[model samples]
Target: MKLIIKSLIMILFAAGAYAADEPDMKAGEDIAMKGTPEGATACFACHGTRTEENKTGSFPRMVNQSQYYILQQLKDYSSGARNNAVMGPIAKALTDKEKADVAAYYAKILFPTPKVKKAASAVLKRGEELAVVGDLKIQVQACNNCHGPGGMGMAPAIPAIAGQHANYLEAQLKAWKDGQRKNSADLMGPIAKRLSDKDISALALYFEQVQINAGKAVAK
Candidate 1:
């Protein structure tokens, strides 16, 4: 009985310490709703809330992202590897724990997809071809090759693009092509460079129409 009690005590103490080290989710929620005093903008202003989809396609949906992926992006923004006029300042302002907390907050929530305008069937067909089967002429692999089937995202590194905002997707592709975004330079850089403006538009619209369930990237 004495040995069992001692073991239980040790286990409880370890669990308490582990929980203490974990990010404070309530603090994260506060940061999201209200920007940090460090000069970061309120994430809700751009990323939206759990109940609301992003107001426009200009912003990428933040929910459903993995914590590691979110953290890396924040780090990249701060380091200028992924330069953005808006995100650069925001990322720089966040302390390390704040970054972790916010990442944790977004990673766990699954937001609903907003209704989006449909693209022309022809355009969607072309986009589907690009996403499902890459164009041999350009030697570009299917977007799904890395993003996972249905753009559900492979997690840890890749982001789910299915049901993402078309405008945001277009913007990112353009950024990659223009060499303005260097985070995934070796991979997305080459692919985006090969895509024409029309192709980019089609791909973006197609992905925006894909059905994604939950934050885990399940296909509907």
Candidate 2:
């Protein structure tokens, strides 16, 4: 409540249009925690509250993300470039400034630690192999090739996939393979299509246990 009030106050006192300056982070935080009644939705409802002790969830973690990445995704959703039923409307409703604001807010948050137990040794090994050096037999590239060291993302596009939910990762991989998700890197579709069930589970579970904030390194 207090945070919301402060955000409102900041907006009230602020002067001039936002064509050239940094976004209002306080306002963004409010929107993430409390969506505008008619415009957008609270991000925390699906994206997790970002609390220190919160468990990993099916929704992608948003904190510690690149600001440019978040804004681009929102813009893509709004423009129909990303085809998510739930996010499309919400992104469409948000004003450009709102999108920028919230993106800035989330970007400043700390990346969460691993919540799930580590995968079995065999699963872990295969996952690492696939992530670090992909499978030549399947024509798959390593996960780290684009996601940067530790899956920190390349910024302005791509995203940090380390420590994301296993279910979410697996579902997205399957979605790409099945053509259920059209918003993606062109390279992802063919790669996903070639993945076996073993690859999907191995990659998902492997990355889920990776801690981007805990000294995890992106494979060289």
Candidate 3:
């Protein structure tokens, strides 16, 4: 009984700490629009200001990403755990609060209906097979198992990959394959290693073309 009481107190304290660390969405929006005082760049120039655009998923749609996933990626870039020629320097320039704020700002934005472009039938079929069900012969797990259905992301951690840039997705997968990106070792690493170049391209293309349900974004 006494032990249980102590555990409850510890849990409450941890929860309180998390709440205090939550970023201010308004402050984040300011940073996204304008450069930070510490020489950080404006995110909009690369990421774009709107939810959806006329172009293909090139720079990526940031609005529906999970705040925690975005923050973790920024921290990874800052610490050189994840290396990007552009993002590495940009992330390094940001203060921790600035990172949190920017992530929060993006998370609060609305998810727009994507203007998806069709991919080849063969590629789409292969992608669907790999995503919805695992390629068991290579020991790969279904992406949806972690990313949720249609790669809409399992919130509070995973970022939505649906309707993301095919090039960007392929690059990241290659990074994991080559040991450049080292964020999700236990999960993403093995899976990435198992993927062939063709598999990678197919998966990226599939996600690039699938639209997410705006508010719910649940697995189908």
| Model 3 worst lDDT run, 10 consecutive residues | 1-10
The digit string of per-residue lDDT tens for model 2 on 1-220 reads: 2443354344334312223258898999899889987679888878866665335466677745777778878888999887888899999989988999988998887754655876788998898899889888876778887677766665545578887778888988998889877765355777888998788999988887777645454331
Which predicted model would earn the best lDDT? 1
Give a tens-digit lDDT track for model 3, residues 1-220: 2443354355345434554286888888888889788877888877877563435445667856877778878888899887778788889888899899998888877655655567889998998889899798987778887678778886666678877778889988888898777766544766788999999999998887776665544322
Q: Report residue 145 deviation for candidate 2 (angstroms).
A: 1.3
Candidate 3 Cα errors over 4 Å, as ranges: 1-22, 51-58, 216-220
Which residue pairs collide, candidate 2? 150-218
lDDT, candidates in the order shown: 0.82, 0.75, 0.76
For every model shown, the clashing-pair count is 0, 1, 0
Q: By the TM-score metric, which is better: model 2 or model 3?
A: 3
- Arrange candidates, best TM-score first: 1, 3, 2
Q: Per-prediction TM-score, please? A: 0.86, 0.83, 0.84
Candidate 1's TM-score: 0.86
Candidate 3's TM-score = 0.84
Residue by residue across 1-220, what tens digits does model 1's lDDT show? Answer: 2443354355345434532258878888999999988799999988899898667778898755677678779988999988889999999999989988998899887787677777889999999999999999987779997788888776666777888888999999999999988887666778899999999999999988887764344422
When 1 and 3 are scored with lDDT, the better candidate is: 1
